[model samples]
Target: MELKGIHHVSAITAKAKDNYHFYTEILGMRLVKKTINQDDPSVYHLFYADEAGNPGTDLTFFEIPNAGTTYQGKGSISGTSLRVPSDSALEFWEKRLSDYNVDHGGITRQGERNVINFRDPEGQRLTLISDETNQGVKGGRVWDHSSVPAEKGIIGLGPAKLTVQDPAPTVKVLTELLTFKQTGSYPSSFKGNEDIIVFETGEGGTGAEVHLEVRNDLPKERPGRGSVHHVAFRVDNEEELAQWRDRLQTARVPNSGLVDRFYFKSLYFREPNGILFELATDGPGFATDEDMNHLGESLALPPLFEHRREEIEANLKPLDI
Candidate 1:
């Protein structure tokens, strides 16, 4: 009943066009799925991933043009990091951000890894990191259609930073409930140089890492644009997913009760710090609906919402991608 690495990081974006351009045009990620939010058909639920829309490579957004900027504080997902291939990949990204006038910082050491930090157009905190084991190894699903070359393209998700005021309780949930082991502690300049505890899922490299930032002084966050809706951890198949649900119930943790998201099965529950966590399966991938060559070319709807496709389409703002 071990969890795999991060399946995806879903965040909020008020500006659909800006979010689309920043991720696809500037950052050069492939828009693998163009779908409406199943919970709210009025807004778009866009998925950006590697070439083939692999589970670990996906980074998604919920479009809410009127949603205000997020209030950053405790109990929020502070940062979403992307995995790059090498130190040279970081150099390429630094020049790429400069060329586009994107505000970013030079490469810095985060423990044993090198990270190039930046934000999306909507001020969503993001980073690109390369560890020694993953450096120079070309990733599994490098997008050929991306503006950035396949070699240097962002491969997948790295460590996601969660800001929690109380670390001990949250750490207990991570260790006991989720089965994440604390790998090490590193100094976090974001939390006034406080030590950030790093936890891992036993396998995978950068995608398996989760950093918990302990800062009691930070206030609670009000969710809006640039805030993470939830962080999903991967399970291998239906068998593994069922086992996870059983464990959650046994531990007295309330969950979303096995939701079928069409692309994957999900069970959502909030952790001790009130940050939303999801257990997502890795099969029935993005290509389940559309062909591999034309994954996000058109909007796809789930069966429940399929009857009102025209109505949903009318409500959603047109994306120029």
Candidate 2:
């Protein structure tokens, strides 16, 4: 009946090739899946994660060639965090990002934890959260294969920052409907803005929390490259997901019900602020069609799209991995 922690966060990328190099090489995450966006076969939908493409570890990007810059503002996933092992890992990353010329805001504090904010080549806002004392839904283990040493490798997704004008409706949906508990509130650091509210579910920790920020100063977001498409929460199975679909419908929440993602079953819906949310099953994972050892090495298509692989491949621009 409870949604597990975060499943994955999907964002947009203008150049899949550069996104691949940065995520896999510089950030040292594994490109676990290379496939076409099922809804639009012409572009790539790349997945990056830990040693194995575990549910909580997934960070994905949809290729949108030549997309515009995302104007920083409200009604958006303002920041996405990647969890690391400890504070020392943050030290390694600070030097690493500087060495690679990655834009960063140096290490800072978010409550008791050490956080370093940074941006990708595409200007995607990101934060590295040090999991020094995290005790809830455990983080994924990074393999020794990553360019960054195993200890410093990014483990999994952390709290997603949702910025909006009004937080009451989103808070109601998360606490009342989705069962997330309002854990706490932290300073926004920006003068005159209200403190960011924290909500958690399942085993509640860095991995299962959502941080809501109120911002009346900014306008609605103009999403483009580097913009988050949605954030999904984990469900145990399709049966559980189906029950959730019924729950949403009963409440008249208006959701995309029972989608067969092949890798996972999903039900997508948006909160009152128009930020997308998804409930996704954790099984029939990335290994469903491809061998684990060879993941992301070649193009993968779900069974329904398998017959049209030739057409799909012809349309996608080659990502030189």
Candidate 3:
């Protein structure tokens, strides 16, 4: 069975308070889930998305207090994109980002669409991609309560860019192992570099594509405050997820087996280049524990972690947002 588009992109953030404010207040994306990183219960794991926290809409962050700045380079999920409604939405975001004093490289054409590349306060690389010409997998609905108007609000996720030294192995993992179709290539913005290759999956469009850029010049990424931890692709359900587990075994690709993330089931594996990739099922979503109208108002813990909620809550610094 084919995998769906990008499920979510998880990154690191040193300041949960500021991170919460930036995403919810400035970017205007809704805080869909407030929880702790399951692997490291001491830190916070925050999820921001559309009103419903749909599978393809989430952009999450793990809080690591006082982490160092990321030295961005190769072998990394270089940039994460958020889908907005139309080309005109880019004009709105350009003005909005400026008004908020956010650091950004103004709107420019990337491949076929107009995109605005920018960084969060923690130097998290992000892009606002206009879905004006997007086809295939459609985006999620906007949060009606967002500070940004419904028409201009961020809708869902777009492409997650993978920057690596060589494209062959990574390409093989995506094309051969994951079944992504190499759609096309685009001219590199970097001088002396090869054109970026495009790979597509379910329904194939901006929402369901990966843009691979080969950069032999940059060093291997040293992750800290703003580095991407991993990027997860969406699978339909647990039965399919089990089959995928078997497939990975057959292919001899080591994986995390099957994991219950409470909100979703997942299988995590790194490619030959060492960039983390996860295949996650899209069920038992964020609303599993919280009321939809009041999501992110308080902390949420998985059922297994529920027993230690008090201890977990005590360890986390009280987040303002």
lDDT of each: 0.86, 0.93, 0.93
Cα shift from native, residue 136, model 2 (Å): 0.7
Candidate 2 C-alpha lDDT tens digits along 1-321: 999999999999999999999999999999889998889888999999998899899999999887898998998999999999999999999999999999999999998789999999889999999999898888998956889999999999999999999999999999988979998998997998999999999998989999999999999999999999999999999999999999999999999989999999999999999999999999999988889888888999999998998888888877783
Better of 1 and 3 by lDDT: 3
lDDT (tens digit, per residue) of candidate 3 on 266-303: 99999998999999999979999999999998999988
For all predicted structures, in order, the TM-scores are: 0.96, 0.98, 0.98
Model 2 regions more than 4 Å off: none
Cα-lDDT of candidate 3: 0.93
Shift of residue 183 alpha carbon in model 1, Å: 0.9
RMSD vs true structure, all candidates = 1.8, 0.9, 0.9
